[model samples]
Target chain A: MLNFDSQGLMPAVIVDDETGTVLLVAFMNQEAYQLTRESGQTHFFSRSRNRIWHKGEQSGNVQDVRDMFVNCEENSLLIRVKQHGDAACHEGYQSCYYRRLLPDESYEIVAERIFDPEDVYGTE
Target chain B: MLNFDSQGLMPAVIVDDETGTVLLVAFMNQEAYQLTRESGQTHFFSRSRNRIWHKGEQSGNVQDVRDMFVNCEENSLLIRVKQHGDAACHEGYQSCYYRRLLPDESYEIVAERIFDPEDVYGTE
Candidate 1:
């Protein structure tokens, strides 16, 4: 059995199938996990919203699963996928990990923003 | 500032600097984070052990940080490192993610075990 923690969630690391670049890290509840398996799309438990989130439901940046793996402890997952859109991050970057952390404890943008967030999500 | 969860922990994804292969996912509290920065080695907060764990302290498989990244939301981190020794998993695999999940929901070993856990950790 997959080991969900006390909060009934396990971390899922999403990776780019072709590039092997990690796209995002999200959490999955059992329901979200089953949904992802059944649908072959990414699903995550939204901690802030307290609901199941179908990734790319709003942005059309769906991730098509190529493969999934569980860690030795079975407490975490790694999913390699074909990202369907120009970007994965809500901030319009190809991956959420766009900033590099420097030794000085500061960060610098290391990736080119792929799209305009204002055009995709629109201003609220 | 990096966002730690309600429990004061943030997930850190470790990646192979040379291959971009994801090695492991672990949790880091602020102290562990600072220690990692200072020492250039991975440190994690062990949930079960209730303390900071210096990765490879006992096994001698320490991961030396090459670079680090932060996600857009600042809730997670990615660390690229030069992994010392042959393996990263306590289970004796190059990566903890050695099992690929099949469509039938069963998993298969996708990686070679580089060492024997019994030899490293001993029967405890």
Candidate 2:
């Protein structure tokens, strides 16, 4: 049996299926695991935010859980999610990861910007 | 001036610019902030993993950081990113934000599976 630290929460990597895009990653506690298993929708326990969040709660862009795999160590989870909507990012972008490391070990922005944050979050 | 607790780290949401996909979310310290600012690429501090992780370091799928926004509270950071390569999720899917909530408040898998994890991670 897998001994999970529900309070501690486990690490999970969320990935995109199409266009090979990675959407977002977060932690999953026992409650989240049970919820995810029961619901099949992506559920995460926000550490810094300290809350249980379901992707696309605020926005219509929801993450649909497809399959799950537990690491051999049984400490981490790799979740495959199918994204819906225009932009999963609250900032109005297609992905949260929009940076790349160049050959010189430096990074550069390669992808195009999609959404305006002011419209999404109602910036001040 | 914003009094940031570099040690404590700050919350960051990573999102895709295309198809409105959310890739991954992680924390960033002062150093990481500077690095990302200088590089224009996404960098994060893995809390549970306890290490500095550059997205797409292992896999070819790299997150290209596009723009950044600081929350009104001046605590959290919302980052815009562009994704390259296929299936950011280790399980090989279009997005990590898969699954959908039905009208019955139940969740269901909506997207099709694209890749096999064994091919990507190399099964044990």
Candidate 3:
């Protein structure tokens, strides 16, 4: 079981510890945090839209929480989970942090893309 | 080109505007801010490890920044990018957020997993 502050909100990131893969980052409100605590699942609060949005609610790319850790400060947290989608990224890729930066101050795309957006989300 | 506040650090999230794909979330320092402004690339400051990390420096999954937006409060920012990997999430899935919460307060995995952890990062 994980302990959460009474503040009712914590910054969290889902990471693949073995490969150092960062799945996604979001905040958890009291309900979301408690929900995640009761169940080994990942939940997040959408700061942009200001709503309680569960990952893969519509896409079926759910995160099964395996473990969780709070930072030394306890202000933020990290969760390790099992992903159920070919691409956790909404854009049809595995990781959201796919792009790399160059020493020259530029950046480039490096990861293999999976799932055609047209097929997954349907064409506009 | 993007302008930076004197504070030298800005919160940012890269998203695919079309599909509502949240590519990644990270902060930007002044140097990283300038770098992204000069070049259409995504850069972030790692608050955890406390360092400057680009999206796909090692994995080659780079983010090509297409657009940038600031919140109404201007405290946080958003970047629209083209991800180059099968999964932008480090856990070998597309998104780091891959879980859904049920009405019963439990959660479940819903997405399709892409790469096998054993193959992607080797066994424990």
Candidate 4:
């Protein structure tokens, strides 16, 4: 049996197949996980929204599944995918990680925005 | 304002600083984040138990904070750390990622067990 957490959720790591940089993290339930494997697309179960949502449903930044990895306990998953848009982050960055925390205990912006959030999400 | 999800949690990605390999994924609350930064260690908020937990408290495989990264929207965090001990996975592996999914839909074990989980967690 696949080990789902007490919440019936398993965390998924979305990463760029070529670059190996993580795009973001999301959660999946059994249904979402099965659908993802069958459809070869990325899908997440929104605990807050109480629904399964496609990755590119809003921003057209879909992730085409390349491969998957699981932890030994089968409780966590790593998804390697071919990212389809100029950005994966809702904030218009290629990767969600755009800022780095410095050794001085401050933060630094490390990545450039690949797309304009206002243009994609349309002013919100 | 930091975007805590509707569930009042933010997802965190843990990565090995030297190797750049993602170790695992966890979640944090504002309090957990503050403690992590202040203590230079990894802390997580367990949604299931509704408690704050130190990563290495039990396994002694603690993560020493090296740096941190925040996504553009401040919704997600990437933790760079120096992992202590031989393994970070409760399954006695170096990382939580140990199995790779093949194109044929079968899973392959890609990582070796660095330590004996039976010796640590005790025979289940």
Q: Write the per-residue lDDT of candidate 3 for residues B14-107, one digit (tens) a residue.
A: 6664555554456698878777767667777776667877776755667787765443234455567777765665556555444544445344
User: Each prediction's DockQ?
Assistant: 0.92, 0.07, 0.05, 0.63
lDDT of each: 0.94, 0.62, 0.63, 0.85
Cα lDDT tens digits, model 4, B11-118, are: 899998878788888889989988897888999997657899999898889999897888766778888889998577888888888889776757888888888988
Better of 2 and 4 by TM-score: 4
lDDT of 2 by residue, A1-124 (tens): 3345535676666666665555544668777777787887887787668888887787667888776644433455556678887466666666654545343534456556676777655766
Indicate the worst ten consecutive residues by lDDT in candidate 2 chain B.
B97-106
Q: What TM-score does the first chain of candidate 3 have?
A: 0.81
Candidate 3: misplaced stretches above 4 Å?
A1-9, A17-19, A103-106, B1-124
Off by over 4 Å in 4: A5-7, A47-50, A101-107, B47-51, B101-106, B121-124
The residue-by-residue lDDT of candidate 4 on A1-124, one tens digit each, is: 4688767888898989988898888889999988898899999998768999899899889999998898766778899899998578888888878888776656788888888888888975
lDDT of 1: 0.94
Output DockQ, candidate 2. 0.07
Chain B vs. true chain B: TM-score per candidate: 0.97, 0.76, 0.76, 0.92
Off by over 4 Å in 2: A1-7, A101-107, B1-124
TM-score of candidate 1 relative to the true fold: 0.98
Q: TM per model?
A: 0.98, 0.50, 0.50, 0.84
Worst 10-residue stretch by lDDT in candidate 3 chain A? A1-10
